[model samples]
Target: MTAITEALRRLPKVELHCHVEGTMRPSTVVELASKNEIELPTSDPTQLYRYTSLDTFLEIFWLVQSVLGDGDDWARLAYESAVDGAEHGLVYRESFFTPARHLDAGQDLGDIVAGLAEGCVAAEEATGVRIMLIADIDRAYGPGPGLEMVQRLVELRRANAPGTDRVLGIGLDSTELGVDPTDFAPAFELAGRSGLRRTSHQGEVTPPTTIRAGVDVLGCERIDHGLSLLDDPELTQRFVDERIPLTVCPNSNIRIANAYPRLELHPYARMRELGLLATLNTDDPALTDLDLTYEYRSVMDAFGYTWDDMVTIALDGVEGSWLDPTDAGALRARITADADQLASSLATG
Candidate 1:
């Protein structure tokens, strides 16, 4: 492989929009289901993740979350999930976990947290990848349960303490079609009060107006699937000016059949051209059947990205992450050094 391509292979990335349930390895999912005596909707692992429609995909997604029935399930799920991310050249991964989904399945919140914490520790040790949890509150369930979910999430995070150094942020997910960002102001405010980093899925299925509502009303520091944010030129200009990082999942969006079919038609390249902070991610790796390196390469192969363009986007991920300044600086330097090495090789060639 060329030096640039090799750099892309070993180049580390920070994942900001990964879903814990959707990211489970199909093999691991079956093992967990078998161990817990939970029946899967699809016994075959390959057929389990062949999702096309957004609605059906969500149905299957919730079904798998159901198989993770107890706290130990959460621990094993969390731990095993991170290893997959690490193996894919990801140095840092913040997984979105919805405890309410598990607890509503009759699993206790404490147990779920305990299991996830165990998995986080094991995964970190196994792969040398740092992992963090982003507590996700499903909007379709309404704000009352969301309020309780956040409270329990905070308690869960505090309970694990130093062992699970990975619990870091809160995210708003689930269908955004009916739920307005303003509906859960109280929950977000509570998250802010608790000092958790905040992000939300805003415009994946909604118009650019919904993105405005999220930035103005909900006060999210970063946005997941904020593709529609490009619709408004002035607003897009502001996004570029502010450098608000957007975690763009082109394959995931296309898999949902929500966006254009081709990668060039996606907002990722436009976001980059406008100088907006855009980072690539596998929102659901198993569902999309790809990793960070593969996603980066596909984006390049489809969009014809140059070495500098790709490296700059990698740097943007480090700048856009919730990592402490020191960590961010370290990752940034690694990208820079890799880029320089690739350039030197190109010059020699």
Candidate 2:
């Protein structure tokens, strides 16, 4: 590996847009498929992830999610996801887990949360890379189920169920088109009332109006994607003024949504230039054959971002995170000090 690439990989990162289910290793998918008795379209795991568009990708994503038959399966997925990320310099993440299909399949939410929490704890012990959960609502399931999921999550928190403490927030993701962001207000409102932080996927392919609704109506503290926020300069300025974070997964947009013709065409640089807290992330790392290392390196390569610029991006990630002020300050200090030491060593060699 190039020296710069290796250095970038060593830089600490905080990921907010990642889906734990999307991080399942290909081999794990095959094994879980077998264990769960779920038939696969292809026996070869390599061919299992091909997709032509976002809709097609969601089909493959759902198939991957279906492999988790029980808490054990969820634990395995969660364990591997965090460990894999830690290898590539992910220090902390607010990872999303959408259990809509599992819920529809009659799996208890408590079991899923407990399993993920168990896996996270094990992974943390192994790597010292912490991961917290965000119980995401799948937009395809509609607002009723979305509200229901939040209600159940509140119950879990009140009951102090396993892993409930690790669950930091609620988010909305999956199938953004043809879905009204306002329709899920009840769900977000309940999450807010229950003291859960909120975020949502918006403006990936939708307009900036929806992005505005995500914040103003649903009270989202962060906006996932928000790719089209620049389309409305007024709203874009508002996000900048308010310092709202946009967890932009540039490669995922290219690989999954085909939003940009190439990485160079992504608006991440512009987002940064506009002073938006657009943090870098890998939405589905394993599925896209990506790691945080490559995510940072590729952005640096594509946008000609210098080491200092990349450091700024990393710091912005901490700012965008839901970490409490004290934790955030500590992490910011850590990143700054580590980056300084790494830069000094790199300059010598």
For all predicted structures, in order, the TM-scores are: 0.92, 0.99
Q: Which runs in model 1 stand beyond 4 Å of their true positions?
A: 1-6, 156-165, 342-349
Candidate 2 has which clashing residue pairs, if any?
A: none
> On residues 254-317, what C-alpha lDDT tens digit does candidate 2 reach at each position?
9999999999999999999999999999999988888999999999999999999999999999
Q: lDDT of all predictions, in order shown?
A: 0.79, 0.94
Q: Looking at candidate 1, what is the lDDT of residue 242?
A: 88
TM-score of 2: 0.99
Misplaced by over 4 Å in model 2 are none
Q: Write the per-residue lDDT of candidate 1 for residues 145-224, one digit (tens) a residue.
A: 88887787677667754334566768888878877788888888888888888889888988888888777777888888
